[model samples]
Target: MEIKNEYLRDLYRRVEKRDPNEPEFLQAVGEVLQSLAPVADRRPDLIDWGVFERIVEPERMITFRVSWVDDQGKVQVNRGYRVQYNSAIGPYKGGLRLHPSVNASIIKFLGFEQTFKNSLTGLPMGGAKGGSDFDPKGKSDMEIMRFCQSFMTELYRHIGEDTDVPAGDIGVGAREIGYLFGQYKRIRNTFTGVLTGKGLTYGGSLARTEATGYGLLYFLREMLQKMKHEPVAGKTAVISGSGNVAIYACEKSQQLGMKVVAMSDSAGYVYDEKGIDLAVVKQIKEVERGRIKAYAERVPGAVYTEGCKGIWTIPCDVALPCATQNELDLAGAEALVAHGVMAVCEGANMPTTPDAAEFFQKNGVLFAPGKASNAGGVSVSGLEMSQNSMRYSWTFEEVDRKLEEIMKGIFHAAYTAAEEYGCSGDLIAGANIAGFLKVAESMKAQGIAY
Candidate 1:
């Protein structure tokens, strides 16, 4: 793994030395750095200004303690963090994941990725990510509310509508967002649109829940049509994760005349050769708040498997990893390629390992990275910000249409950028180059600042 640019290599070495134990952060920085060779060759002024060095470091990193009482009348403590990674383009924008895996490295990686993801939307947004090591599962509503309040009590000081806006992620959904927003309002005494995933009655945008999944399919469809001279119709798709992204991706796939054969959760994956029943899955995972095992038990033709990773082995024409970071490794990519997968699109941030992504590319799989493919969530979040600012809402069709257009724009921008850089079909480099150039230019215009 040798870097081509001497200055870029030096910057990366500094990052590695400064955060040796932060593998997630290192991996993210390494990937972005690897793609900057084209930019470095074209923009030597950026190198002279040390843009790479400054971009790798966050504008601010805030960490605080969150202490709440559970239903058992015991005081529980958790750590919370928010990494305001970069704000060259606009205010910091990203999600907050309230999982036990929340850490500095993970938050930094997500924020670093968000910087580009937000830029790709062509919207005025920077990058930031925050979360606590708090697990909302098995907690009562009141318990969750108390925890959200505690988390927001310290977080409110660091965020605002025009400053840094945080939205929902893994464990942070509508329920948590409502709680956090209420707490922020209570503390700040302001009803500004500080959060995007609010209930529709309170300024949330429509089609947000389905944005990431639907957006993923839109981007994938365009890629398939351009590269393979076909649409998703009649393709058997294997998707990981049964959450909002996967469910909506499945819905969009079915609507596009494609059949989704598999979807998974943390416990395991379910495979149905006749295409997944999105209705049954929604009822189980959303309404019933149950694991995917219930889906297998209730669905007529679905088979349940034991582990999440094995979902990749299910034969399909397309594969969507919407589960979590690094969920799909070389083995999973190899399995999909071996099964003749035509395309691999990421619905989760950094879901596919670098090697896996390269493997898919080398094998002629039309691979779309999460930043470009699964950007619908934040793209709609940006729209939600607009609706909130205008104090108006758009119809579902309106927002969905706008989302489709944005995804298409993102694809062409990345596709063309890759082709321009003489790496046609290499969306990994294309997306990185496209997004990096946008933020880099913005940073340059703003002048160098510590």
Candidate 2:
């Protein structure tokens, strides 16, 4: 599993010298470089055509000021950004994350991951991600509306149905998408499908919210079956990030007979020895918009820890890191392995760092990287694009079924690729190799764009 990507190494050096502060960007490059190991070992055309270098850097990364007035009449300025990573296959498509951690590095990592995640879904969508540093929590609807409107005012000119289509991520949800899409419509005066995660009344697709989480479980199920691992029945699992991905992953895992004992947010984590109460979690996160600490009050015997770390140390057979990027570092991963975690699936993109990923692989743990495991969200996003293009929407069951199938197919692709590359059990390598091959072939076929 040696990576011969000399070009990737060179690009990494240049970018490292330029942006030393952007760990997310470096992590994204590292994951891609890990994937390109097999490709670089096998392909000279890719090296000669500069495919390794060009794809490492985004096609365009736009930053702007999102200036809006709060309810207190104070002018609040937050930075907004969009990274169009690649589009050799189709229009740019990814989610918009509005966490306070929003920056060029985070967005670039998400967008870079999106490139292959979308490609792995067998969809014709490229990768892009945008977000603002504006925190939606504790903000009134009016203030949030003004912020979305301002963000979209400039972003509208760069995106459309035929161009880049964005969806909701960490801090952005149906509410944010509704506001952003409303502004787009008001400005463009066209009822086109410019965004995927819109409200149902405004042409949004069903099952989109459950796509990523459920898709993660589906992929994990396939992995378990292929590897002849134990069924999820009676398994204890820990999930971080009580957002859409964590909640849905909790739901599907519960249905599949896994007990999710822990879930977390940026502020902290909640652990219920009897498995998380999905209803309570949804109420706190989805409706009340409260922190993870609130779950302790409603659920008996549940305790809330004031940090995202060590939530992984609670001893679980399955560990799903649905939190933000690199939330599961080497220490956390070592803890999970020490606790005898048999399976680790990423429900969040790049949630595990390279060192952690290598630790899991080296320790013989079944690892599903974000590119392969958490791709359900963008795969459903691609489904939304299809429904929009055809002027129709599918039923929830239909969409869910398609999502499960897609996730399973992606799992098989990685599984098969791993076997072919002689890294049969190294799914991290398999996924990176599989996803990179898809974009690489497309990049080569498209030839030099300049």
Candidate 3:
């Protein structure tokens, strides 16, 4: 372990050269480097891609050649990845994503972000991310099953109930989890809780489906209740991405008496003047498994647009970007401010760009960064781990209550850390600094690993 600032620069250079234009990767790495600088100074020996950087990268980023037989028996070979990024805090825990955008850089970036996010939750879960380049939208069920089996064949060796637990992400859901879990059981010769997001008949948590969305609103409630600032009820809200996170955000917000004006997918967004109908939207998304275009058809008088960027243009007091990384840009931030947006809580990881985040802070918006807001999903996953170990089940209300308390505590921790660091009103810095401090302190106390 050598503490050389130049080594970090070299690591950044290598990543940048490989990615070239991945702003998200660069931004995430930059934040990590910033957080680790103090640690590097204190333990200069742990520098230069030492245990820290290597752990920051991945213990093993297994990219295997997955060839599966489709329904027609035509063999399809897709690149699959599982970034066992960091296991210092606990076993590797993250999600499996499947989309055209899946790649090593993206997976690594997400895994890196998850390390701190998991740590901040006070959960004994490390961070990892796995996914494939296969899109499940057009794939037949048989084809998806084959692909999942193929994926689990390689993923089984590196994961276990006490080792690593992967969950659902953008493209992987109930069906995919079932397939993967089945494969894991067949390969491991045991029925264990090696994965979260399992079917209810299995070891999955009850409220895991609605965890992220509900947890986000719970965090927002705490953020709003600070100093009795503002209530989400009666507030106009906009959410991006018509997937699980977006749909659930709408459901919870409506329950809290908010006017959700719009929700969107990659194709576009649907905006209704008189608050979005949660049941219809959920049917269109969670049930029908369709795009937001169908949303306008189901709900009369609602308009759907093709480009998702314009989603932020609609006026709202609150905006929840549950879509993807960097979905809300600087212009979107300005638009939200212009429309009198009071708060922006992220239900997705790194949904706001650095510039957009800075713009919101400069304009006085209550911005709960993704790390604090979207932690509900993983926090509950940790709870599921407990239930699995104890061989007991908790009521949905009980799990939801624990989620609410954790979200509130995370929000408060970040807020108080900001206050202590004299970084008032700047949540991005507060969150990044606070989240990293806990992990960094733990890493240092553990001493260097050979």
Candidate 4:
């Protein structure tokens, strides 16, 4: 979309000129600015306050060196980063990702998107993200622990329960969180809710593991019911990635009577005519840490494809991209549209590319942006924060109920905001506008420095 608003155009140009090399961050900023053009026409005060300018830049960007020893007694080094993007509404809250692809651009993009995701949850939390490029795939437990300890040695001083809280993402899971938390505790000599996604024995909340995946279906259900008056049951769905998000999303889709016929991972995808066997997938991904292709070998009459992107070619009524950023491109969107897919809801952060998302919208497919659909993980993180502060925990049913309500509220907020802003049925605009307005108002109320 072209930026017709002069104020937004100029602000975007400044961002482009300042961060010429950060394409991911530039893309995120451009997408949000495009959606806010309508708001800029009505709210001139935001331009005067320089909210857009400040919002695009991180409040604090920290980089440090993490050095650890391997089992071979060899010294290894890695880079760590924490981008405290915005805290206008509350303290910085986001996840700590660990992947070889981690960098300044990706971290900034995730952090920028997170500000809105946290806001859409109607929770008192800001947006921040931290991670390292350390690959935990083949590392032994002790090796991973050493890396986490080294990473936390520098990170502990900058985080706190009331200041900034970090959780797990991508490569950072329960084991990684435990190691990082242990280091933080040993260094600070105090236990607090500085981290979420902790073990059940610690500060983690019930239903936290399944929050993002389950929350996604809730949002999709509301969108389907409200927009088309269609029920989710009996619908065929395809989900990508066999990680935590995809696994639980499949589980919820099956529970809702939707047939999840296909699922994928980095290696490949498996298509089962009889619908996916969740137990087998869990055994392969969670228990054995095996490849997705193994699902085909175990399940009768299942076909396995070599490439992950080919999973989109399969026909389905609903398509959920639960994979990483930009996993679904224009071609995938076109294929889904040609197959008569009704809705596409994101389960990962920015899983759909700009053109693909636009294509889905143009083709009458209900599209839900990641900032809205994937906010479930952070929503539960916020709940975990509350539980930790209260020194109490909610039952799984209680937490799941709250999660369902939060997801529905997010859907309605986006739906209503889009309609109000003359972009009815365009959830991208609605979600961006609703989430941005809340943060922008809070920023304006707190003054320019905030």
Residue-level error in angstroms, candidate 2, position 447 = 2.0
Per-residue lDDT tens digits for candidate 1, residues 1-450, read 557888788889999999999999999999988888878888899988778888899999999999999998999999999999999999999999999888999999999999999999999999999999999989999999999999999999999988999999999989999999999999988889999899998889999999999999999999999888986888999999998899999999999999998999999999888878899999998998889988789888889998898999989999999989999999999999999999999999999999999899888899999999999999999999999999899999999999999999999989999999878989989999999889988888889744
In model 4, which regions exceed 4 Å deviation?
none
Sort by TM-score, top down from the best: 4, 1, 2, 3
Give one digit per residue, the lDDT tens place, for model 3 in 115-159.
878888988788888899988988888889999999889889888
- Angstrom error of the Cα, residue 177, model 2: value is 0.4
Which lDDT tens digits does candidate 4 get at residues 1-450?
A: 577788899999999999999988999999999999999998999988988888999999999999999999999999999999899999999999999999999999999999999999999999999999999999999999999999999999899999999999999999999999999999999999999999999888999999999999999999999999999999999999999999999999999999999999998999998999999999999999999999999999999999888899999999999989999999999999999999999999999999999999989999999999989999999999999999999999999999999999999999999999889999999999999999999999988642
lDDT of each: 0.93, 0.88, 0.83, 0.95
Task: Name the regions of candidate 2 deviating beyond 4 angstroms.
Answer: 1-7
TM-scores for candidates 1 onward, in order:
0.99, 0.96, 0.93, 0.99
Q: What lDDT score is found at residue 70 in candidate 3?
A: 85
In model 1, pairs of residues that clash are none
Off by over 4 Å in 3: 1-23, 34-55
How many clashes in each candidate? 0, 0, 0, 0
What are the RMSD figures for all models against the true structure?
Answer: 0.9, 1.6, 3.2, 0.8
Question: What value does the lDDT take at residue 441 in candidate 4?
Answer: 97
In model 4, what is the error at residue 159, expressed in angstroms? 0.5
